[model samples]
Target: MLRAQRAARPTAVRIDGIVKSFGGACAADGISFEIERGTIHALLGGNGSGKSTTIKILAGVYQADAGAIEVAGVRHDARTFSPRQAWDAGLRFVHQQQTTFADLTIAENLAIGHRFETSAGGRVRWRAQHRRAQQVLDQFGIDADPRDELAHCGIATQTMVAIARALQGVEQGDERVLVLDEPTAPLPPGEVRLLLAALRRFSRDGQTILYVTHRLGEVVEIADQATVLRDGSVVGRLDEGEIDHDRLVELIMGKRVQAVLSQHTRARRGDVLLECDDVVGGPVRGASLSVSAGEVVAVAGLLGSGRSSLLRLVAGDLRREAGAIRLAGQPVDFSGPRHATDAGVAYSPEDRLASAAFLDLSVRDNIGIASVGDYFRRGILNHRAERRDARRLLSEFWVKAASTEVPLSTMSGGNQQKALLVRWLRLHPRLLLLDEPTQGVDVGARAEIWQLVRNAVDAGAAALVVLSDFEELVEVCDRVVVLSAGRTVAELDCDGLSDGVLEHAVLSAERAAA
Candidate 1:
């Protein structure tokens, strides 16, 4: 009974001949797809493969220049419907990057999509709205008090608020269409599975999900049908039975040799370059570790794992409640990121917009932000030296852009990440602290970034890398430190290690919840 009776079900969405472009580059070209009622249809592709563009158009963020969108068989001009209209038509989109009023309470965030009207007496119905929101939160296994402020919660909880807001229109009589874009990337394994199960529960209730993700294994696991896009065109749409990871990769890349990526190897021996002496922080407890030069050391665990907090403490972005950090066998006092930098440490923060780049500033300024000392003459920025310095790293890192003078935000997401990396790499630090370095980068660029990290380590600088992709840990890291709920549970050495062993160690290292 739980089989694909799509032919018997009503058609939820029908897209035809959607075409869009930017800067003369094709993003979505004559793309066509159909979503059946009560199905989780996945849009899978590389960063620039047009998947995001198609999703953006569906979400009313972008308009299709030459296409038609039909929701519940009602034809749309694609460009005419405003965002509010899309919502009115039962389209709820959850962006991968969670957006919320950080200062607002959880209850306030849940009531965001409520349709309010003034009563005759001008009375408010806030109580009824909060109760309705309570039912929604209960469905997601969230038992926290609604009065809790959103920013005070963990990233996963904040993401859940976004999920609940997107589901607000489900009780309406219209066809329920939900679009979730990479909602699990920021989550750890346990939370990721929990969210995936929630999605499956939603699917069972006749909700149509247009899910977009880069994790191929997840697509194969959860998608009712997989749609592959390459260079802005629909290359393949595979039903559940016909899709596998290899074929999926080939479909996105338009060729073979991708088969080798799964079986690749570049492991080598290196010397220890950094050691943490019972490193202690608010979230990280008694975390002792040693990382070698020319080695990629990874911190692996579930979402609330002390991974990011550990890196932040080491880089001096957080207050060290106790313990210490050593670089090249020398005791270091990292009072702040500046102190860390002065000690030849380069850290790429997690939130790029807030911590990494001056978004509105020129790429030249963002790239030269960290080590502006070299391009400054007695506190005054030397424009000529800054241009030369920015250009040198821009080319070295293979950042694709018109010129160094262009604004950092104007560049693609991958390029911005590259610029951030360049900003730190120029420092030639003894240690590199990369927190989700390639979070939103494209696959091709992801490989390049990996190479850049490896090249830095190979150059004799110790590296501590934090990645969402567990496979990336096995691929590039020589040693992995497993953190569980803000504690170091195990240290898995990569010497003669297989992917299976690394994964098991990471999973098994979890301490019993206290």
Candidate 2:
């Protein structure tokens, strides 16, 4: 009977001629696609290429100007669809940002958005809720206790809990479809493997998934079919047999771009701009590194290797326990981030959404906020000068926005990152600290960011970057510093660095230390 029902309805989601326009920009222009039931379908696109807009339309967050959406054997006009309607049609979404409360228990977080089990008197049944949450967790193979605080679990476990929660009310025979947007963006490589394995399990159990991500390798590994969107239009589609890395890159980029890092040769290497002498703070233990003027140094390590800790210590986000840091040969201890910023230093954190960007503010304000002093007159802001500077920075960074007045939340992740970088780079600091600068950005924007970093170094500012992508380290860094177990293990020049070489070096150091 289940097989018969599956045979009768083949498509889980069918979107036709979806069109969405934001003022003068047509985000989704005549987009069309179909996801077969019980298969993993991938949506690929560059930043501001209408991928998010189309997904939002399907999620009923935005009313499309014109389109038809058929989900779970139910059809709804995109022009008048609502969130409740989408929910009733069995569509669930796990957005890029995590949607869980750290302070709450796993059971409580799972109960959110779904109808909680309650007593006849309308009081919540805590015991039954924990059992139900545990069942969902077990179903997804997530090793977490329902009664445990979500903050106690690792990031990977928290992510799986969020996914399991989304599938809580869904029954075995229900024609529900899950949409995951960049689910693995924040995870480490090992955690990503675990999450993909669980997703494959869901696909095997006759569940349909629409996975959106910038990681092409994961797409080839997990997706059965892929639809590529470029500039608000469908450019290519690939079946399981055709989903190779090179082919997908060509389709999404519209060019055969090599992933090789450019060999950067600085014309003049000057004195040390920033130096960490036996820095010991947070997870860092006796770590030491240096960056010279016109040089870009990258810290490379696996998860828990203290890469982020080193950066935070230098940026003054963490207090140094023991050791000293010198900037431009002057020994200085920063009391806080503001002190760091005041002393000719700039830091771009890894968590862009939480730390770097101001979502509620306009793009103009985000870009020009740090430089407000330059546009001040007798304690009054020079509005015209501020806007003019914002416009110039927007144009210079190639941010795709209709105008500066729009909220920063409206722009794509890549554009927001560019704006954030522009915000700090305008300071012309003596030292720059960047953590995962292009973690969620698409390929095209990545090149632009690399150029921006290079430009900064060329203008005599030194940079220290922490990245998980070894390929990016090979391309962007003049030297790579490997850290293991909170200690500096080895330092290698990037003159002939390859991904394999860097990985082998880090792993070899880990094995030695073990």
TM-score per candidate, in order?
0.86, 0.88
Q: What is the C-alpha RMSD of each candidate to the true structure, in Å?
A: 3.6, 4.0
* Candidate 2 Cα outliers beyond 4 Å, as residue runs: 1-9, 113-131, 169-171, 258-269, 302-305, 359-362, 376-392, 404-406, 495-514
**Cα lDDT computed for each candidate against the true fold:** 0.78, 0.86
Clash pairs, candidate 1, are 188-303, 272-292
Looking at model 1, residue 232 earns an lDDT score of 85
Best by lDDT: 2
lDDT over C-alpha atoms for residue 98 of model 2: 89
- Candidate 1 residue-wise lDDT, 1-514, digit = tens: 1344355467899888999987776778999989888888988877667887888788778988889889997889876656876887788888876777889877778766564333678764667656766777887667666778898877777777887777764664459688888888787655676677777777877778898887777787778888888878899999878878888878877775343233435445466678887788877887888887777788887666688888899888888888878787887768888888888888888897787689888988888777677766777878887788678778899887779987887676777888888888887888999999878665666777877877787788888888767766676677788887677778776656775676666667664544
On residues 50-114, what C-alpha lDDT tens digit does candidate 2 reach at each position?
Answer: 89988999989999999999986678999998999988898889988888899999989988857
Clashing pairs in 2: none
